[model samples]
Target: MRLALVLGEVAQGLRRNLSMVVSVVLVTFISLTFVGTAILLQFQINQMKGYWYERSQVAVYLCTSFDGGPCEEQAATQSQIDAVENELSGATLAPYIEQVEFETREQAYQNVLEQWEGTAIAELASPEILPESFRVKLVDPNQAEIVIDQISGMPGVFEVKDARAFLEPIFTMINTLSLSAVGIAALMLIAAALLISTTIRLSAFSRRREISIMRLVGASNRFIETPFILEGVFAALIGSALAGVALIALTEFFVGGYLAGEITTIGFVGTSDALVVAPMLLGLGAVLAALSAAVAIRRYLKA
Candidate 1:
């Protein structure tokens, strides 16, 4: 009977400030959606690093006639090539090097041709413009810097490039985006909290007479406050449910449907990631609402 009465008071409180309750719900929905997206984006970023870091290699580019630095206007001689090859298989670098694939100037030019087949840039491309290189697959991708330091100062090498350097900018951008989502979510959560507080205060004020009568009849603080807290919880529950649905749609259509087709090279987040985040969002919203309501109720009673 007491549980039924508390639930009834909760429903009554929700009806008194319908617009404010709706405002709290919308704010919570938007906030939690941003929170969920930020979490999944971080998850995707971590997965991308794990998947791509293993494949990243270091390129040791041999000098060409057209190249600057170390070449002095002459192509790499056969002796320089031999020296580089010997150094690669030698005792010092042998531990770090997993496998080495050599690319000839002609092979490089054909690759450029196929890559820029129909472009105007292809017309100006020549074998002499591109440098032949050894693609070194390292035993550990993290050991790339060591290989670079050793190979960079070697004769006939124009540049030592780590492929992982290319991925840093992409990850940096994703991280920035994640931080931005978190910022937006923070602001919206504050709005939700304030709205929840305001809604509780209004409900309390409207029921002030009944509350005083209950007090006169020896009602406990828990009995008076339980219904008000439940009011916030119910609105938050609706908002959380909506946020969960939005996260599912985002994963299904945005990551799975679109990004999976367009960017095939990198693995994206899946529905399971969203499902994992849904419960977290629900709990977070509930906590925010409950705290806000408790503060409002305490302050209103004292006032």
Candidate 2:
């Protein structure tokens, strides 16, 4: 009987302010979606960082050509290559070095051509301009700078480059965007909470006379509060459910289609992880709604 009455009152409140209820639903949906997107983007960024960083290596390009000139037979000698390899193998930091693989200019050019197949730009550059390089894989990517600095001044080495250097800017931009989304979501969520609170307060005020009569009839405070709490929870749950659906659809459409093959390094959160977070978002929304309603009702109950 108590549960039925609570449900009835909640339904009545929702019906009385249908527009406000809709506003609460839309606000919560948008806020939670933003929050979820931020989390998922962060997850994707971390995942890509881990994946790429693990495979990251410092490339030491041997000086075989100068000033856009072709490689001369006398440019980089086999002796210099062997000396570099021996020095790397004999270093005190040898244990941290995974393995050093040498790629000839021919191999590098072939790789470039293969990657740029069907592109007219590939034909513009001569393959002979490509320089032979030592691909130095390290056990720890963070130690790449140390290795690069050590190899940079070597006789035959012209440049030492780490893959992370090229990727840092892109990641920085993504992180900035994610943080911006979070900031916007926070502002919207606060507005949503305030709106929910005001609606609940109004609903409670409308029933003040009935509540006072109930109090005169010896009704407990819990009985009076349960309906309002339930109302908020129900509204939030609906909103969260809608948000989750939208999020999942957006992720699937964007990540699975547009981004899947475009960037080999970037990856999105999988469906399994998305499913795991859905319940948490829903619960979070419900909790937030209940808290907002409770706060609004506190003074009225006290009076």
Regions of candidate 2 where Cα sits further than 4 Å from its true position = 67-74, 116-124, 261-266
State the lDDT of candidate 1 residue by residue for 1-303, as single tens digits.
999999999989988889988998898999999999999999999998988888888999998888876888778888888898898888999999999999998999999899899998788888878889999999999999888998887788888999999999999999999999999999999989999999999999999999999999999988999999999999998999899999999999988999999988778999999999999999998999999999999898888
lDDT of 2 by residue, 1-303 (tens): 877877888899889878888989999999998888888888888998898888888888887655222233335678888877887787665977999898987898888888787787567545577878888899999999778777776777667899899889988998999999989989988987898888888889888888899899998988888888777788888999988887787777777767876866556677666676678789889989999988888767986
Evaluated with TM-score, which candidate comes out highest?
A: 1
Any residue pairs clashing in model 1, and if so which? none
Q: Would you list the clashing residue pairs of candidate 2? A: none
TM-scores for every predicted model: 0.95, 0.89
Clashes of each: 0, 0
Q: Which stretches of candidate 1 lie over 4 Å from their true place?
A: 114-120
